[model samples]
Target: MPGLGVCLALAASAAAPPVFVPVERFTLAWTHSIEKVRWEEDYAVVASPTAGQPPVLQARTARVRGSGAGMEPPDDAVLRNGWYEYTPRMGSPQGLRLTRSPYTADYAWCVDGQCVPLGQWLPSDGGVTLLTPCARPPAPER
Candidate 1:
């Protein structure tokens, strides 16, 4: 992916200057507050369809345990070990906005089988966090 120089930009509502994570691919994982089911979505950084646009997140796969409420698994999704796995219809999004709450566990930013609380990188303070693909490495935080 030469010329991509891509990274994931994590910007909290209050974090004027976002902290970036250098990754070509990663997963955003979390557990349901009520159902306690694990949900994970894998994403890859790829060149945008437009000729000169920055890279965008191509959602690769999505998996979750159990289905109810807003967690219904697609009919084509396969079930194994109580987990439903399938490729997401999401082609690419300009960005993803996650609502951070103090009650539930923080979202997990997983890479290379390592999962870390996103709070470790940027403090959301019960605010919203935006994730998007960046064309540059993050600048050193002040």
Candidate 2:
């Protein structure tokens, strides 16, 4: 019975709540404008102000797992410059500025009125680049 108690303790500690801490901030510049960015934990958002268009806002959410300090381009990424790179894992919210949430070890794009359940990280499951995010299908205004 004492051995069983030890196993339970170990499992409980292994599943500690995710530790969320802001790791870094980078600006995303584009032809039309730039975006101010900051992300951690379950959310990543990019905001851009256009000349005549409503400011673009892309918000993404995921179930956080673990935290890390930084990110490196995936094996198949194309290096554009010191701060810019391209990876096949790009998602709908493509942007020039890219980041993998340090607070999210595993993730999924949260979409649909009923959010998708957590799933494995897809190679094409990253956040927006330094550009536009996935636009919604037009729906009739109520």
Candidate 3:
């Protein structure tokens, strides 16, 4: 019976699929004028509306298991404005969704309707961070 149990354990281990865990997801939104930036730590967040224009910026980040294959850590550009979709090793048919991207750098300042390039600007710490509001897909023109 002990031998049978061991066999069963091995079989289960072999059959077990992979699993994925999300590190975190953050989102930042800025108005077209780029006057102010709003941040959301998780999904389904509603930011207080600020005076600005349309064309807000959106960013997302996620840690995936099998999906990370061949994909390198998100780059600055990706961290700045990339939509991430992660797939786990095993479990549900639909994997977790880190709908929002975390701020990569620690500091974010706007000037003349543009986010200063990374490195050029500095947050309290050297850490990276993101800034913006929730993003919606472009609407179909009438």
Native-to-model Cα distance after best TM-score fit, residue 70 in candidate 2, in Å = 4.1
lDDT on C-alpha atoms for all candidate structures: 0.78, 0.27, 0.26
Query: Which residue window of length 10 is worst by lDDT in model 2?
Result: 1-10
Per-model tally of clashing residue pairs: 0, 11, 18
Q: Which digits, one per residue and each the tens of the lDDT, describe model 3 over residues 66-111? A: 1133443334313334433332223211112212123443322233
Model 2: per-residue lDDT, tens digit, 47-109? 234443322323322211222244433444443322333423333243333343334442223
- The candidate maximizing lDDT is 1
Number of the top TM-score candidate = 1
Q: What TM-score quantifies how close candidate 2 is to the native fold? A: 0.21
Candidate 2 Cα errors over 4 Å, as ranges: 1-51, 58-63, 69-108, 113-130, 133-142
- The Cα error of candidate 2 at residue 72, in Å, is 14
Cα misplacement distance, residue 28 of candidate 1 (Å): 0.6
Q: By summed lDDT, which 10 consecutive residues of candidate 1 come out lowest?
A: 1-10
Per-residue lDDT for 124 in model 1? Answer: 66
Runs of candidate 1 with Cα error greater than 4 angstroms are: 1-15, 49-51, 137-142
